[model samples]
Target: MKRVQAALQHFAQAVAAAMMAAMFLTFMLQIVVRYSARLEWLADRFPILNPSLYGWTLEFCLLLWIWLVFWGNAFVVRDRDHVTFDILFVTVRPAVRRWFIIISGISICTALVVSIEPTWAKFYILRLKKTATLSTIFGDWIRMRDIYSIYIFFLVAVALRYAWAVYRAVRFGVEEPVEAPAGQPTK
Candidate 1:
């Protein structure tokens, strides 16, 4: 399980990194193309220029942004880095803190479990729709569902993490470990 999780963590990080690079390259290419389109001098000088420069760049970037947001949530769960309103949690007694942690984990798990089916149905319906660029290029369409695959993975990943947390809370007291045994790994 640990090895599988490590692999998934590495894969997610790679995907995130690749998306960031692709977005940067796409934006830079767009900027160059836009400037070239504006400047008659550049256009006349470079006969090879496609003033449109893969008009799908914007839509692609937006798609990448969506995946990045969703995947980042999964990564946060893997790393246990999700933001918490810790002031109240910090002020509480340890026993109260355990209850708070367990309750919050249960609430999140409940919400996610409840929403999963409706969300999947909505995404299924969206499979009928095509992106603007695909619609323009091909009368037939690429399914929006295919584009949103990462989001489904992200939801399941975070939900499972929450469920695991709840299980851990039940088995082991929920007060976060503050000290490490000698030579033990942290986090």
Candidate 2:
């Protein structure tokens, strides 16, 4: 179980890194083309006429952003990196802290379950209608909008992982370390 969780964490981190790189490269390329004299002619030929004009670049970048953010969130949950005001808990007994964490985790899981289906259905409708800003064999047929499904996928993954973490906390009564804020002493 630990190995599986560790693998998932690593995979999410790698995917996030790749997505970030892709987004950065796409934006940088656009910037250079717009600003650099050497690329002026090329830019003029392929002016940013509209969101549609960027075609795959825009769609792919948007998808990458969604994936990166979602996956990064999953990573955060799996690693228990989400922010919290645990100062109050610090004074409480460990048993109470464990129960509190479990409650919070269950709440998060409920929210995710409630939201995921509706959100996914909305995306599915958009995809089914072949909705897109740009029309092309590559964009329309391949349907870049379908990529939005990844958002739902990652959200579900994160929710499940978090729920599992909560269960582990409740059953095993383990409290992961909390990092001290900047300039604060380690407890």
TM-score of every prediction relative to native:
0.81, 0.73
RMSD of 1: 4.2
Error of 1 at 130 (Å): 0.8
Put down candidate 2 lDDT per residue, 1-187, tens digits, no spaces.
9999789778877778788887999787655544553555564675653333454566567767777777676564435345657678777888888877798888988898889888977776565565354354254565534666667777788678768879898779966556789977554
Minimal lDDT window, size 10, model 2: 47-56
For model 1, the superposed segments whose C-alpha errors exceed 4 Å read: 1-3, 41-48, 76-80, 134-141, 176-187
| Residue range with the least summed lDDT across 10 consecutive positions in model 1 | 76-85
Clashing pairs in 2: none
- Top TM-score hit: 1
CA-lDDT, candidates in order: 0.76, 0.69
